[model samples]
Target: MKTDADAAPLPMLYRLYTAGAQIASPILDRMARKKLQRAGVSKARLHERAGVASQERPLGKLLWIHAVSVGETLSILDVIKELRQQAPRMTVLLTTTTTTSAELASKRLPEGCIHQFAPLDTPAATKRFLDHWQPDLVTFVESEIWPHQIASVHDAEIPLALINARLSEKSLMSWGKRADLARALFGRFSLVLCQTDPVRDGLRAFVQEPWKVVTSGDLKKSSDPLPVNDLQKARLAQAIAERPFWLASSTHAGEEEAMSAAHKHFVAQHADGLMILLPRHPERGPEIADMLRTEGWRVAMRSKDEAIAPDTQIYLADTLGETGLFYSLSTLVFIGGSFVPVGGHNPYEPAHMGCAILHGPLYANFAQAYADMAEQEASMEVADAAALGQALCALWGDDEVALLQANAKFYIEASRNIRKDVAGHLLALIAP
Candidate 1:
């Protein structure tokens, strides 16, 4: 089914040489080892085989789903849940790249599903992993396209699909330069379900196979908000009782500065206000705390046994997998990574927790969902740092917090059932 255009020579030798250089670098080797150690605990559950591994071999056709990180792993939880309910006997093998994502997936995936840390993309490792698992169907979440892995699956005659498929503008440009290579890589997928029309068009430039490509709304929209534990919720509620608090969730590098500035401005008016800044990567906790401390702010880190004192203006929630706790405690929440060039993180978590949502301008990744929320007045989009501070201050001063909460609730209700549409299509593809 591949076109003549796809048969062009690839930069395979160059790519192999580049990969060898990276592998030979001592720094990269150490980092890879550390990453493997962190993610390998669950990965060991699988039996190693031809460039792949079997996590759990339930007696039936195995359906393998691979998602790289926290966002992608969380986005597909609902689909896995639905699949379990519909086919109790079906074995699902889930793989993730990061330790945090693996932990999250293990906690959420149903009993029939097995979790593993996906092997590093080296040909030997990929081949060993595939040989062990021997999946009948393979579904990749988001844009994690491993060349050798996909090619291996294709060679084995396994049905392959790319779910919630997305290609960023930056990625598109890079792939555009190697159109033939891209075409060969993508042509391996039996189906390619894109998140948006832009993604579809972007993919079409490299992949001319029209029958395989189609658009399905983002799978993240269909994801259920992570559940909150009663004990944790109660403890957080007590900690935040009657205090004016807002959450800066999933903050990236530059975003913390913007958030700290906004927090300072908000606290100037309401002296007792608190800001909970949750960095996207918890490893940056100590650095963020030091940054805020240098600015004469009393910052308390979650990892430390520092109590939330009355004088504490900022609480650095540098813990992993606890966004729900912060969102539940907040009256208003700002989803970070939007202020800087990094695409926005999910806004649905705050909406599900009944928190008034605020974001910055560059949310091209989830533009449609954000657009809908903004149009319905369920969320607010600020122009820049100053506007973000102003919006937060205004929301804090408003007496009817119920209005904001209601807007968030309405948005969540309206967006329900999107997962079912995506799941239905996937089921049809995998039908026996």
Candidate 2:
């Protein structure tokens, strides 16, 4: 399987890889089992990870989408819904790597669409899975790649499209070193719709094709703001009773201490101000709780059934799939991963919610999105706790908050056509 481009030579290392998989299958299987230790796989549907199906294949052109996690899954929801509406006969199959993603897909996927755990990336498992599902067209979101699965799909002459495709700076440099391997993998895609020009350039250097690749715009920009429960939102609003609040969402390891200190600084100036801190990984909730408590903050853990009391300084929302609720309650929302070197989580989610988006200096992961926001004056990039605290204090007034939110709304409106645009190109490719 090849595109009509001058692809770099396929690497000799690929054959060695599959051959190695053959010998190390047992060890790999054990690792796969260990992955489920944290309740990521359902006991009833556990076989799905082993390339066994619990549901029979639906008859139609199955447009299979493989997105790795909650972010990727949510980003493509609008695209999938548009495609399903445009071509009613198209049955959608969405697969994710994590149990949280699978649970999310079950709730969010459109009617008639199926959600399943992705099969393990070994030849036997992938073959068993693909042979059963027999997807007509396969799409991968972001940068998830499984060598054997990709090869098997191409071997069966499936049309592959990579939507909102991206590679980090580190990934691009590493792949450049292994040009032969890069070409072997990237060349198999019939189309690669990259998020930015630089990403398109990096892919072009490997596949060496202009025709198969194009800038599709970021799919996330078009997704609906993460959903919030209206009743819960109303209750939270009443309980707080017009208190000034800001959210530091999806905080990672190093940034936790800084954010806690920042919250304390702001609270010193504004007595009733509160900070709702949400960790990126809920599993680290305990560690964050311990750290904040030790630092003398009145921390209330969501997992422990603690609510935002009148005296509660830091409200710790330590659970899955609840970021949307907090996004709805606050206008000044700081996306956390940027504060440290962990790249950044998607600020677009908050931007779409019309947040007065806040970030630290480091935000390479979603750099283009942040740049767009900054250009519109829709967001603020703070350097440290002092800056973040001061900004929060200044923005507590109604007029300033409204102004920032207006800018965010403008940014969202300016960049919304990507889902429809990308869906049109995808439908064209998959059309019979």
Candidate 3:
């Protein structure tokens, strides 16, 4: 790490960015709260984001990790657990941006670890949070780069790493436009493990030192399948026994309508067919259920305490954090949030569960996971509703479930060592 004012000045654009954030920090707080309110952030917890401590930092060496949201958080819990067991004296401070991520982190973070809402990216807030926590090592999950936060850590000479870093086409163009800014921002990290070749290549092109970038295994591939209660899985299995079923997991606004169209066509061929539709936001359960009901489908919502009757065509697994249970009951799980414009959700959930997976063409969020799946024929990508319907019919027509399931399992196994390898590097960096 650079010392004695050797770090480059924030590039022109980033300097302006930080200045703007600092200048508007007060107004920004109110606007942020409004945004958080719309997203269901807890009112009591709003102080944390303003760089106020809700809980005292534990005594001893601390590792502060930033996982931007639920999908990014999911990939790191297993690693965090392993790190906790490996270093008993070290405490983990996990920070997330969204309410849903905070909720999941509270349950899954290892014992003694603290979960806090990440501070907004203003100079003062970043400094206050850094000074209070005094983390021994800092890690950012995925590509959640905050200019002020990175600057604070770098200036302090903290050991920093970025895991599962990725770059979409839009992200690539944005970074590529300012080489000096990109390199200055990225160079602060002691290590960067990219999830895909394109991301690795993009970083190399953006930065002067290409050595920091590597095409590495995605953390999601190593995550445990979404947790499922055994009793719950068994009950669901019995309820949907001997029925040809497909699932549309983690769907978005536009994609559900498309999947419903496909389901209507699919049910015509298989009378007892059922489709499990789990929207990306479970709060929209009523809206989604009502939308399908008006289309002449018998829909049962999980949140509403509706059970799947014999004639129920769609079982809406509309609750949070039980996706794994439904995965066990599904023969064909269409990884959703892709059929629409919103970049797709994590594909690793279905892959980790050994479910036969399908998705739309827009699944850029988990590009590496999907790429690996495609390489091994573990999943299929459909073009649109009509194409998705045809693909569903094809899966129904053939006895390829065994083959698809095996391939999905194989893809996950291929990357099982990623977490250990990443943890090894992290431990060495912050070794006592």
**Scored by CA lDDT, what does every candidate get?**
0.77, 0.83, 0.83
Q: Arrange candidates by lDDT, highest first: which order?
A: 2, 3, 1
Q: Which stretches of candidate 1 lie over 4 Å from their true place?
A: 1-56, 120-123, 208-211, 399-404
- Prediction 3 TM-score vs. true: 0.93
Between candidates 1 and 3, the one scoring higher on lDDT is 3
Question: Candidate 1, TM-score vs. the true structure?
Answer: 0.85
Query: Considering lDDT, which of the candidate structures 2 and 3 is the better prediction for this target?
Result: 2
Question: Candidate 1, overall lDDT?
Answer: 0.77
lDDT of 1 by residue, 52-101 (tens): 44434667877889999888988888888888777678788888767778
In model 3, which runs have C-alpha deviations exceeding 4 angstroms? 1-7, 31-45
- Tell me the lDDT of candidate 2: 0.83
| Model 3 residue 86 lDDT score | 80
lDDT of 3 by residue, 266-360 (tens): 88888898998988889999998888999889999899888989999999988977888888777788888787777777777777778888889
How many clashing pairs in candidate 3? Answer: 0
Name the regions of candidate 2 deviating beyond 4 angstroms: 1-9, 33-44, 398-400
Clash list (residue pairs), candidate 3: none
